[model samples]
Target chain A: MIEIIDLTKQYGKFTALDCLNLTIDKGTVFGFVGQNGAGKSTTFSILATLLSPSSGTAYINGFNIRSEPKAVRSQIGYMPDFFGVYDQLKTVEYLDFYGASYGISQSERNKLIPQLLELVNLTDKQDSYVDILSRGMKQRLCLARSLIHDPEVLILDEPASGLDPRARVEMREILKELKNMGKTILISSHILPELAEMCDTIGIIDQGRLVAQGSVSEIQQRLKGEKLIVVKLQHGLDEAVRFFEDQPMVSGLVKREDGHSLQFIYSGDAEDQVQLLKMALLQNLAIVSFSEIETNLEDVFMEITKGVELT
Target chain B: MRNLLLNPVLNKEFKLRFRSFKSFLGLGLYLLALSVLMVGFIFLESQGSPMGRFRPEQSRTMFILMSFIQMGLILFITPGLTAGVISGEREKQTLNILLTTNQSSASIIFGKLISSVSFLLLMIFASMPIYSIVFLYGGISPGQVLVVLGYYIFTILVFGSIGIFFSTLVRKTIIAMITTYGVTLFLTAGTAFLFAVSMSVSQMGNSSNNPFALFFVMLNPVMILFSFLEPDAFSELSNQLGLGSEFPLWAANMVTYVLIMVLLIFISVKKLRPNMKVKSRR
Candidate 1:
């Protein structure tokens, strides 16, 4: 659980966060969506008790981050966007060092090291020097180091950046497992579609301002009026396209396949639109699947943050 | 638990500072040079005065003086060791991870300070055999050696803390190191010059002792170190048998120096308190 109230940060005349207010429930994957220099990392850094807010109070699991920072720190784990491993230390030794930093006992640390190594799938590489590991492996090890104290919440600032596809998938799965284990996570990533599939709630930050924050569908619903439908047909898509062109609600259609599927960008919601499908059915278009694909977070991001282009 | 929490920093410094072949090579050559020079000094100066000739009485004085000289070099290196504690971590991008942990800023700063100085202390301690050789000349007492060693310890801690403070405040290792060296230089050499000038100026009129200038001597570790090293050389030049009022009784200077070291450490810690801000969560 986390609560940030009126969180504002500034550097002289430049503001990093603008009276930001946000709450994340336990076990909820809260995606902090923001472009570069969007104050997302600033907000994360403050929550982790690494940066003092200019004016704000952050609470983690009911512990005030400014006052009871140690208590708050004990309850939260932070994985920075970029991290370094102790160059000379082994993977397990590195984890144990952080475990010791969190006040975990040596005996307990010795026991936890193996489990953590296994969790990150670096068991065989426990004795390997951390600097020699690949970027993704290092990232995974950084995540495990944050978990050495078993903190209740994880604030991961762009954990997937620079990771290869397989590594990103593994990182995602690891985070999903952490979420399934009832740990609340605040994740920031450049990959919007991946976040769209994983996050229950999302907050978009642009130029130190929170322009939108809510569920996926709720955000999509808030998009300026228009709807898009993706149709996947088994066969005879040419016939289906000609039949759907007559529909007044369909403002635009892009043929995506030779004789299969295409998307219809409709200007109106036009409920009880089954009449169009019925008309297509009469044409023997052999339509297999047809559904509305509303605007995604990526579309909304482009819409809102494309700033001057949108203007 | 506190020690465990501190060990990583100490461990990193220990492994890196000790495991390197160059460090060991430096230590070996340093010891060899000191031993050869010490033996040569004792052998050649066993008979007449040390200036044009040598006296057994002044032989111990020379050793004590050399001990302080070695401590001066120790003082010089202490800042180099501690100056990188924070800034080097920042350069490597390791400071943020440590800062984000449950540990308080005080602990982080203290741990770093201790780790940085730990190796210097080890190097100084390794030179103890050379210091112990002074006892064989029968002029200096074991207590004097201990008081001198105590002075050196405080000297290193103060210099080391100054370095750590500058390291925390500066973002570059070279800048932090240069700043630390500059501060130590000012404290060690600058304070001595001020005291010498004040002592001379005060003695010109009424032969009155300047408690204020004497007070600065209390604050300067190197000056206390100089007091412990240098015997009453002026009196010795006049062929006095024993006792000169020039060196503020060694025990007193030693105690005063230790107290100053403690106070400076506290100042460093206090200065760090307001700046080490905690991170914010989103």
Candidate 2:
């Protein structure tokens, strides 16, 4: 678990993190969402014990980051956003070096290297030179290096930043596996959908301030104020649209390009929704499908930060 | 102490340094330059003395020349090797990862210093055959050779520590390298120039004895090595300069260098610590 309290970081006159506070529970994946220069990396660096907070404290697994940095460092695995691999070093050597840096013995590293490489799907390239690997491979290797000590918390800053779509999916799968293994993860990325799918909770930071924090649906519901419903018609599309347009519960409606489906924002309770469906059936409207259209994290983010400008 | 010596950064530095062709080429060029000097010294000696006869005095001069050249090489190459040790990591963006590990800043600093000094020692040891050529004529003793080796080690520590200190202070490797060389140059040539001025000032004041002049000479590593090689010349100069014979000159020089090296390493470790500025502010 990670806890940050009133963490503020100021660089001369400019504030990088402004009284930011967040908590990540054990075995939960907390996605940190923000645009560029949004204090996400600053927060990650502070938690990793690589940067000092100007006037705040952070704790990882009950160890304070500023006072007990070594303990905090031992408990967390940090993968930086833009890290470089040592040239002329083999993949296994790279992992072993970091393992030794964490005070892991040779025997331990030897046993752990293969397992970690396999976890990142880089076992075949264990003997290859690190410089010869592609960017995606290097990123995976860095991930494996971070996990060399089997840390309880993972602080990954843009783990899939520059990766291709396939590589990003692979990284996401590995992260999900890490979550299943009971590791607490605090990840920051610009990709909202991936975070929405991967994180138990998402915290949106803007201009060094945490503007929003909640589950995907909670944020969506809080910002949009209505549930979206889609009704697919086999033959009664005009009737369905007319009926919803005249209903008091229907706030907005838009017909799909397919001409057989209609999407509408329904400001009603569950009982009202069920009653509306029953009424449509009684009217003999040929309804092929009726389902709620879920709003994604991207939509929620845009809605929440509608008037806010990026710093 | 053993754990400090066996740190992971030291091991990785050794592996990466020796694995590259650059290390081999540097060693080869170093030995080739020494070989040229050795052969050239013998050739010039034969031309002056005729009959191609070897002499003990010639052997002594050759030993002194070779030691001087080796020390010069160490002074030149140590900065190139160590000035980039930390800044290069920063440039590669690996310093942050290293800092976030459980390894202490002292461990990383010492590991980098030891690794660079160990490679310099390897090159010095590899040129032992050339030193043995001096022993062939029976002028320098094995004890003398041992003392010279010890002096070489101390000099490497001093220069390598300076390199590391600058590496930690500067952000770019090239800037660190230049600053390291600049400081070293000031320590050597600048001290000599100040010593010369002190000598003339003492003479102008009708007192040819100035311990301060000798102190400035002690700041120069080459002068220290020279004093070790030709003790009679040092003694004669001390007699002229009216220096006290209380402490041995070589011991004083060694202590000065060792003290400076320690201070430089301490500052480097403190600079490399992530929270040092915050701690200082508090």
Point to the candidate with the largest DockQ. Answer: 2
Local accuracy of candidate 2 as per-residue lDDT tens digits, B1-282: 898767999999999989989889988998888888888888889788867877889999899988888888888888998999999999999999999898989999999999977888999998998788887787889888888888888888889999999999999999999999998888888889998999999999989679788888878888888888999998898887887788866788878888988998999988896771263221
| Candidate 1 CAPRI-style tier | acceptable
- Give me the runs in candidate 2 sitting further than 4 Å from their true place: A226-296, A306-311, B276-282
TM-score of chain B of 1: 0.78
**Which run of 10 residues does model 1 chain A get worst, by summed lDDT?**
A302-311
lDDT of 2 by residue, A1-311 (tens): 89999999888888889888888899999999988888999999989888888887888999998888889999999999999889999999999999999999989889999999999999999999999998889999999999999999999999999999899989999999999999999999976787989899998887789888888777766745567799999997888888889888785588999989998777788899999999989889899999987777675665445433222
Residue B254's C-alpha lDDT in candidate 1? Answer: 56
In model 2, residue pairs whose N, Cα or C atoms come closer than 3 Å (at least 3 residues apart or on different chains), thus clashing, are none
lDDT of 1 by residue, A54-84 (tens): 8878889999878877787789889998777
What is the lDDT for B56 in model 2?
Answer: 89
TM-score of each candidate structure, all chains considered together: 0.80, 0.87
Query: What's the distance in Å from true for residue B155, model 1?
Result: 0.8
Candidate 1: C-alpha lDDT: 0.76
